[model samples]
Target: MTSTFTVLPVPLDHLFSPGDDINSIVIEALSTTRWPDESTGISDGDIIVVTSKVVAKAEGRVVEAASRESVIDQQAERIVAVKHTPRGVTKIVQTSHGLVLAAAGVDASNTEQGTVVLLPVDSDASARQLRDHVIDRTGVAVGVIITDTMGRPWRLGVTDVAIGSSGVHVLDDYTGRHDDFGNTLEMTVVAIADEIASAVDLATGKL
Candidate 1:
């Protein structure tokens, strides 16, 4: 038998605001959005991947600063590298959450003008809360992943990566496993969370 999975984008029409309940909003949206089989609800083992921007917005992480640089400085724990491009100087730094991202994940898109959005205070905690809420409301065990888009160190384009996750195995360890040819794998740990996030991003696009 062939194993298969699906990626469904939940259409949320309501704008996220400060102090909004994102879990409830997501549940309501799922209730309204029809599945491929015409089902109206989530199922067990379903993985819900969410964008970090919405989570940050709902958590009141938006701020108006003198400049994006200032916000980046405040959020960055340590500077990793810097690059000067035609656009401007791009600083890749490790944030307080230990995420090494360009501009410290200080996003200035899809928000009010002159305001930027920061990453959630604790993304893993946020994912756990959402996962718990889903189980509580729908009685379905689901995995939740909060994602953000970032450019790879040597890659040209950006891709979504998991910054937070819950109710899911974040990594698949094949270190001690043997291959079909009987070659023992020494160091093989796949980041399944980030893979899921990247797949979801392909469907959701850059939001």
Candidate 2:
């Protein structure tokens, strides 16, 4: 799909206030905020990405770190029959994605004191809901991507990747489409979401 991406900067807002709902807040923002209006630049075939932290906050994933660590310990069974000091003896455990990660991708930064934000309990559901809601209201085939900061095992510096997606092709397979130079692609899964993530990162200071 042909898409023109304008870097819409998000201003500071009083997020995560008591009794605050993200879905409601975003819908309200769309309905009320003149800046994000369809005519003001962004439109169909375009993505609407709100940092996943906002979604976590909206879903009440906020929790005290002390309590959250304890919860993780309980959930972290000795899958490999080995245990070591704190943050040792890695074992991949099934996270929300049904894909295992060393520490369930738990995070401990960018939040209020003594609190850590967790991934949306059901991110796929969250994306689907947001996408469906937008389509219902705008009649536009916009895509939604719930992105989160994650660390790779052997890589430094965090990167944002799609934890969930809807109304868009998450991957653009190029296996059948050989390069003009005649190089046959083999065994590849292009991460389109991460590409968008990195682009937004450049335009937004959030990288």
Candidate 3:
């Protein structure tokens, strides 16, 4: 199957207030933006990812009257481990999904003072909803992926990760496949989604 991506450009820059809800803001952004049903000539199995900021906005996950520390406070229940570096990122424990970066998976860039944006309430659900909407709208059997910016170990800057996906498999295992030399491929599940996410970030200049 072929793979592709569609990145929406909204240029959102703001802070989420505590009173803000993450779900509503995301829906609102989607309503305002003209995300067409067309795929710009992409074939099936293409994954379309909207930046986490837009999703967070639509969900109304804005916080106010507090900084990064406060953002972490709300996520106290989800924190699994903490790391120390020039910048901070905690290895978080997730309930509905796997162990991710943080409670809200939030960061301190392109946000206003005393506020930060949290992740979508349910990334997979959000992706499914969007995918269904698109199918209903355009009859396209395309996949959808919701991406968020995240920091990586030994990496200098931030990049996108697949928080949501539909009709696409992030991992491809070839453990049983033998190499040209007849050596079995061992533990060969590639993070294709993440690789595409990084490529999209570069193309869209999401820095």
Ranking by lDDT: 1, 2, 3
Best by TM-score: 1
On lDDT, the stronger of 1 and 2 is: 1
- Candidate 2 residues 20-79, lDDT tens each? 656555655655433534555336676777676777777777778877656555445444
By TM-score, how accurate is candidate 3? 0.71
- For every model shown, the clashing-pair count is 0, 0, 22
State residue 111's C-alpha deviation in candidate 2, in Å.
2.5
Q: What is the lDDT of residue 159 in candidate 2?
A: 72
- In candidate 1, position 4 carries an lDDT of 80
Segments in model 1 whose C-alpha atoms lie over 4 Å from true places: none
By the TM-score metric, which is better: model 1 or model 2?
1
Top model by lDDT, which number?
Answer: 1
In the range 90-131, model 3's lDDT, one tens digit per residue, is 555443455356544765565666667777778778778777
Measured with C-alpha atoms, the lDDT of residue 112 in candidate 1 is 90
- All candidates in order of TM-score, best leading: 1, 2, 3
Given candidate 3, what's the lDDT at residue 67?
62
